[model samples]
Target: MEAVPLEHILLLGAVLFSLGILAVISKRHAVVVLMGIELIFNAANLNLVAFSRYDPSLLQGQMFSLFVIVVAAAEAAVALAIVLRVYQYFKTANLNEIVSPENK
Candidate 1:
């Protein structure tokens, strides 16, 4: 069986990254933005694993991706907690509408 080409993996990662960027830019909700951030992180992880596949002796890419996964999990938890608080106070998750009291 022929192994997948690195260029294809890189292209896929690039597409994922671009989609994540678009979602972050176009979405208004905080949770959606967070999801976009996760997508970006996943894209990076995919590229890392793909590059590391060529050199199995060095597991740096896999290790780094694991670290990123842990960090991303922590980030998602904290971000959701903050979003929950914002929602409780503002009664809405729309970032554009969640202005400060001073601004209102």
Candidate 2:
């Protein structure tokens, strides 16, 4: 069986990263932005895992990717908690309208 090319994995990661960026830029909802951030995190994880597959000696990349996934999960939980609080206070999830007093 022929192995998958590393370049293909890298290209996929790049596409995911670009889509994440576009989502963050074009979406007005906070949760959507959070999802975009998660996409970027997963893209990076995919890159790491791909590299680990290509390099037998560098098993650390796979471990690091696991840690990154854990951290991203924690971050997503905290971010969602914060978003809920914001929604409770503002009654809307639109990012452009979320102007705190500190921003004034």
Candidate 3:
């Protein structure tokens, strides 16, 4: 059995994080932004798991990653609820329109 290098894992994580940042920046819809956030979370998880694998003596990275996943799940739930309400009230999921003063 062979192990993957930490640099490779970190590079993958960096790519995922960059894509997530791009999506969050360029997308106007709330749902797309949420998906971007999930990407970012997954990237973080990947890094944590990679680090934990290298340091088997302590599983703190994995434990923190688990907590991060839990928090991301809860954040998604609450954010989606807010997006839903905003859609119902404003009739659009575009973040720009939702926050626009003209919408009110």
TM-score per model over all chains? 0.97, 0.92, 0.91
Residue-by-residue lDDT tens digits, candidate 3, 1-104: 88888999999999999999999999999999999999999999999999899788999999999999999999999999999999998899997776666655
> What C-alpha lDDT values do all the predictions have?
0.98, 0.93, 0.93
- Residue-wise lDDT of candidate 2 within 1-104, one digit each (tens)? 99989899999999999999999999999999999999999899999999888689779889999999999999999999999999999889999998887885
The lDDT, on a scale of 0 to 1, for candidate 2 is 0.93
Prediction 1 global C-alpha lDDT? 0.98
Q: Name the candidate, 1 or 2, with the larger lDDT value.
A: 1
lDDT of model 1, residue 96? 94
- Candidate number with the higher TM-score (1 or 2): 1
Candidate 1, run of 10 with poorest lDDT? 95-104
> Candidate 3, overall lDDT?
0.93
Better of 1 and 3 by lDDT: 1
Clashing pairs in 3: none
